[model samples]
Target: MDNYARLKQVWIAVIYLLLLAIIIPWYWPEEDVRQFYGFPIWALLSLSGLFLTSCFTAWVCLGREVTKE
Candidate 1:
């Protein structure tokens, strides 16, 4: 696979794992959920990364199978 293809695969895998983490609860000490810039830590990071990866995958797929005139 070419560089773009490899990178795309890595990103797709990472996003899938992140989604799994988000959905499945894990062990965490009871504490107030901290907010950074008014965003929850887990929500901010996981969701943002998930969105970024999705957009990137879409862009790559668009280039792979279609052309714009």
Candidate 2:
């Protein structure tokens, strides 16, 4: 519908995807020992990207305004 609504939908989808990534091992398996900075590679990268993407999306969405203030 509107930019604000579209942004909210994107935000919700991203959050759901992030939750799925956290609960389900998409790239890395349970027995894998590969680590990045002492943390699981998949876990670290997936979460960091998720957080950063969410923040960036929010910031950009905030910048788009239909109302004059």
**Number of the top candidate by lDDT?**
2
**Which candidate number has the best TM-score?**
2
Q: lDDT of each prediction vs. the true structure? A: 0.69, 0.74
TM-score of each: 0.45, 0.47
The regions of model 2 sitting more than 4 angstroms off are: 1-24
Q: What are the per-model C-alpha RMSD values against the true structure? A: 5.0, 4.5
Tens digits of per-residue lDDT, candidate 1, 1-69, equal 899979978987887677667644364335758889997676666677677667766876676765589
Please give, for residues 1-69, the per-residue lDDT of candidate 2 as tens digits: 999899887987887677666645666767888888888877787777777767766876687768878
CA shift at 29, candidate 1, in angstroms? Answer: 5.3
